[model samples]
Target: MVTSLYIMLLGHLINRAFYYLKQKWESRALPSPESHPASQGVLPMYPG
Candidate 1:
């Protein structure tokens, strides 16, 4: 039981870390909203 709890805690921490990294990466990689066609009303839906 203790081992299972420890594994669960580790998995939770790893998931959280990956999620945080993805958020950071996406924020850096994606273009600004001003350049997005949808945001500018150029297109009713996302291009892709």
Candidate 2:
């Protein structure tokens, strides 16, 4: 069915996006001091 095909396409897109982001992050060495402000924008990894 077309609906099932659409769902499968969407799932593939999401998986690809996550994989790309992971690869991009891995290639990066580190952020500069100027970008420290961005850290504030991120929620703690483990929000205990």
- Measured against the true structure, the TM-scores of the candidates, in listed sequence, are 0.63, 0.52
In candidate 1, stretches whose alpha carbon ends up further than 4 angstroms from where it belongs are: 32-48
- Each model's lDDT comes to 0.66, 0.60
User: Please, what are the lDDT tens digits per residue for candidate 2 over residues 1-48?
Assistant: 999999999999999998787556534533443555465325323122
Lowest summed lDDT window (length 10), candidate 1: 39-48
Write one digit per residue (lDDT tens) for candidate 1, span 1-48.
Answer: 999999999999999998787667645655575566455434333432
